[model samples]
Target chain A: MSMMKIGGWIKRILVLIFALVYLAPLYIAVVNAVKPYDEIIKSPLTLPKQFTLNNFVEAYQSSNMLELYKNSIVITVSSVALLILLTSMAAYIIARRKGKVYQMLYVFSLAGIMIPPVVTLIPSIKTLSALHLLYTMPGLLLFYAGTYFSTTIFLYVGFIKTIPASLDESAFIDGANPFTTFFRIIFPLIKPCTATAIIFLGMWIWNDFLNPMYILGFRGGKTITTGIYNAIGAYTSMWNLVFANVMLASLPIIILYLCMQKMFMQGLTSGAVKG
Target chain B: MKHNKLYDTLFLAPGFLVYIIFMIIPVIMCFLYSFTNWDGISASFRFIGLKNFVNLFQDASFFQALKVTLIIMVLTTLIYNILGIILAALLNDTGKLLGFSRSAIFIPTVLSAVVVAFIWSYVMQTNGGVINAIIEMFGGTKVDFYATPMTTIFMISGIICWNSLGFFVVIYISTLTTIPQEIYEACKVDGAGWFYRFFHITLPLLAPGITINCILSVAGGLKQYDHVKVITGGGPGGATQTVTLFGVEKAFEYNRRGYSSAAIIILFIIIVIFSIVQLAISKKHEVEY
Candidate 1:
């Protein structure tokens, strides 16, 4: 019993130390963001002798964070909403139907799961150009619709499978069409799955860098990731400004994750493990 | 029942249209483009018949990028699984501090790779960086993270693992919860030590989770471009370039669209091969219980 108690104490202390080390970068960013450049360079590990919000002011202005935020929010929101609506509707049919065509379509949709977005990106540039959607927000949105269709539909199809078809059948018998039955009846029952899909899709689309950088380019607008990347690129060693920009870029997503920590954890793990 | 066909078409048409036009066709086009010598400009180009792929094999920089990518893939996957399991074992219990630490660890996972790269590049700087400064303060010499291309790539892999370690840990923790407590009790009754029980019972029982984490971490590592791009831009003479970065630079910067498509096709093949092999190996070793 004494040995076990001693071992537990050691484990607890070790975890505490490891956690601090793990979060040291975030702590550094937080502290240094408020410090002057000289102070950050001179004494990075210490409390700042002179604290100012100059870095945030400069970073916010230079990075055009408001515009970046607008772009990111619009893209993330629209893409996720689009994904949920289209994928969920299609997933309903695939889940309920037991025909060869639906089965083949289900397998076809899931094939995208393995094709990394990098593969589609190069050739999509040509397709987008042909459609006159290149370097446009709508282009990126359509790209995301195709890119994430597999994962979002996979989640919805799995969830809808567990919902008893009888409920939707009753709604159909009550003089309701398929759209009315799905939107009014089946959709509400798949709230948990929707939550999961939203969390995953929102995180991916919001934090995406490569796609937005190339697809949107400077012609359309910059999302938070690309904006911050360019902002910090101009001054790579300006640790103060870098920290401020990093914090500014991450603040919203960090808050969102914190608020929905439980859902984020459950949704991500379930999506990966089951998918 | 009367409108079943119409409903199905209505539901599937929009998504299927986008998927086919944007996803499926682009993939097919990517394959076709790999064989041509199209320079991504000029309407006139010739199909060189695998000449671009043939050149890729001879290109030293392309070989370097492949090597760097594989190294990162192996290193990050190893660290994610090994450290992930350890962290999951430690945080599997219920406590306020444990919950706080678990959430804190996951904070970086939510941040953009660019943001994470920016913060870490500052922290790992050779001169006056936080890690080196702390080491110096503790009576040690400074460590230059960018000492060489290999060292930098290794450091970048560590940063990648740091960015997503929480993801693997969470999966492992969830898997841990599903194990029956009576098995441990039974093991203890057999006079088995903790290590013996852990190895015999917990490790084997965690097979499903292990398989998932292996597949995820491997794919994630192979698809690594953002952090490497943000931190080094695959620079210092393109020593730290991954396959994706190589493909992007060639296509966009050099206008070598055909060659870049070949690089991406190679990456896609590697990822597919790795996942399938991992699945097969895991399936054979999966415990019935």
Candidate 2:
């Protein structure tokens, strides 16, 4: 028992060390983010003796953050809503029905998961241009539809399979059509899966940098990420604004995740497990 | 009866049409473009058939990017998975301490990769950087992390692991929670101490998490763009560039459209082969509980 106690103490100390390494940079970031540039440069690692809000103000103004947030909100919420609907609807059919076509389509859809996003990104430029939807909201939405369709569908398919066919059958017998059976009976049941997809995809699209940088065209609009990237670029030496800009870009999503961390992690693992 | 088939088709239509038009078609088009001599802007180009593949093999930059990507991939996977499981095992047992540590470790997962990259890039600055300042305070000489290719690679890999380790930890934590306590008790009764129980019991039971983590790291690592792109911009003479970066540069900057497509196709083929080999090996070890 004495030996075990010693071992436990050693283990505790080692874990503490590892946790410090994992956390040091973030703590460093917060410290510097609050410090004046001179203080950060002089005593970079310490807590700020003098804190200021100057950086946030500069970052917010230079980044055009309100516009960026508006654009991001529109895209993330709309795309997530559409993705959940289409994926869940198709998933219900695949889970409930009996046919080779359904199985074939299911397998066909899964194939999309293996293809990397770049392979589609290159050729889609021409296609997006031709459709006159290049640099447009709907165009980017469609891009997301194609990009995330596989994972979203994978999540819904696995979950919807767990729901009994009896539920839909009873609805069908009670004079509900397929659409009716799906929306009223099946859709509500798959809320957990929908929640999972929403959290996962919402985060991906919101924080997405590269795709929107090119596809949406900087001149067309700026998402939170590209907005901050451009913001920081203009005021490289202005650490105050830089920190504020970073906060503005990240705060909303970070706060949301913190508030709903359980749901977020559950959604993350569920999507991974189901996929 | 006819209407059921129609309804199925109708329901599947919008989603399938969007997918095929934008996804399946573009991939096929990219594959086709890889065989041609199409500059990105041109409306007309002739099929050059295998030329892009030939050039890609001959290009040193391609090899350099491949080397960098491979290095990052291996290093990140090792750190994230090996350490992730150890961390998870420690955090899995219930205690207020464990709970606090778990939450603290997962804080990075909420922040964006760009933000994480920015913070690290600032911290790791050689001159007047926070880390160097800390080093000075400790009476140690400051080290320039970006001094060499290898150090730069390690720093970027560390940041990547930092940005993502939370994900692997959470997954492992859940996987650990699912393991019955009796298994550990039995191992203990057999005179297995902590290390022995870990080696003999915990590690084997965590195989599924390991397998999943490895495959994910492979796939995610091979396609890594955001962090490295933001951190180094594939800089210091494209030495830090990835395969994806190379391909993107070709398509956008250089307008070597067909050649870039070939690079992506190569990446796709590699991902396929790697996933197959790993899935095969992991399937053998995945013990159903």
Candidate 3:
């Protein structure tokens, strides 16, 4: 009994320490984001003596902060919209399916789960150029559809299979088309899947770098990531501006994450375990 | 049935077609082109057979990239799975502190790697870098973590793990929620020690989470480019280069599409092999409920 008590104490301390080490970077980022460059370098771990907004103000202006935010929002929202519609439909069919053809289609869609985005990075250029969709929002939307098709479909398929098919058949009996049945009846039932997609794809597309860098072609529109990256590149040694840029870049998504903790965790676990 | 067949064809065709053309075909094309001498701009290039592979074998940059990539895979996977499970167990309960930590850790996971990279680079900088500043506050030398590619890659690897560990922890935490409390209660009554309970009860039950986390970590680590690219740009003469970075540089920067394709194909094979091996090992340990 005594030994168990001793062991539990030690385990608790170790876990506490490990959690801090794991979280050190985020803690460091928050600390430095508010400090002056000189103070930041001198006392990184210390609390800020005086809060200043110059770095963020300058970082915002230089990084095209508003434009970047707008671009990121549009891209993430649009792609996720396309993804939910297309993927959930495919997943609906595949999940109701038990035959060989359906299973093959289901598995075919799931096969994209393994091909890393890098493998397609170059070839996407070729495909995109051929389609005349390169360097356009629609082109990148198609890319996300292709890139995340398997994973998102996997989530929808898992959730859909557990949903009763009789609900759909009855809806069909009530003069509903497959599209109507899916969009009106089935889609709402799959709120869990939508939650998963919104969280997963929103996070991914919002934070994506490589595809946007090449596909977006460095002009016209820039997502938050590539925009901030370019901003930092210009300010290479100016740590103050970079830290300011980082905070601005992550602000929206971090706020969303904090607010939707349960949905985010549920969404992640479903996607991870199902895949 | 007619409508059924049509819907199947209509819905399936567009999404699947786009996916296959953009994703699957490109990957296969990448595989085929890697064996040739195509400079991407040329109208045509010959099938040089295994020559690109041979050249890749001889390229010191390729070897350095492989080293860096493998180190990242091992380090991030280790850090993610180990620390993830621990965090899940610790904060699985409901509390102000636990809830706050859970929310806090998961916040970084949502931000883009570009953003995370830029942030960490600022924090890890030598002069005004937050990490060194903190070290100096305790009278320690302010070390330049990125002075060498070796040090830089490790720091990047650590940062990458930090960015991802949040997602994995939330997954583990959710999985933990699904575990029945009665099992733990029964084990405690059996005089099972914490280590014994963890090894015997918790670990086996966490198999599903383990398989998922391992596969995701390996794939994520294998394709690590964005953070590293933003952090080092595969710099110091490509010493911190990863396979993805090498392949991207080959295709976009150097316009060596064929060589880039070959590198991606190799990475594809590596990911497949690693997944298969992990699947087999983890499946063997799955204790049936």
TM-score-better candidate, 1 vs 3:
1
> How close to the true structure is residue A92 of candidate 3, measured as C-alpha lDDT?
84
lDDT of 1 at A243: 90
Give the residue spans of candidate 3 off by over 4 A.
A1-24, A34-36, A41-43, B1-3
How would you encode candidate 1's per-residue C-alpha lDDT over A1-275 as one tens digit per residue?
99988887787778878888899899899999999998987788887799899999999999999999999999999999999998999999999998898899999999999889999998888888889999999999999999999988889899999999889878888989999999999999999899889988998999999999999998889999999988888987888888999889988888888998999988877776663
Instruction: Choose 1 or 3, whichever is better by DockQ.
Output: 1
Ranking by DockQ: 1, 2, 3
Q: Of the candidates shown, which would achieve the greatest DockQ relative to the real structure?
A: 1
lDDT of 3 at A49: 88
Q: Compared with the true structure, what per-residue lDDT tens digits does model 2 show for residues A1-275?
A: 99877867677767767777778877776666777778876676678889977766666777889999999999999999888777777877787677898899899888888788888998887899999988888888998998888888888888988888878767767887888878888889889988888888887888788788888989669988887787777766666566667777776776787788789778877766532
Native-referenced DockQ of model 3? 0.59
- Candidate 1 vs. true structure, TM-score: 0.98
Off by over 4 Å in 2: A1-17, B1-3
Please give the range of 10 consecutive residues that has the lowest summed lDDT in model 3 chain B.
B93-102
The TM-scores that each candidate's chain B achieves against the reference are: 0.97, 0.96, 0.96
Give lDDT: candidate 3, residue A199: 83
Please give the TM-score for the first chain of candidate 2. Answer: 0.93
Clashing residue pairs in candidate 2 (N, C-alpha, C atoms within 3 angstroms): A55-A240, A55-A241
Deviation of model 3 at A12, angstroms: 7.3
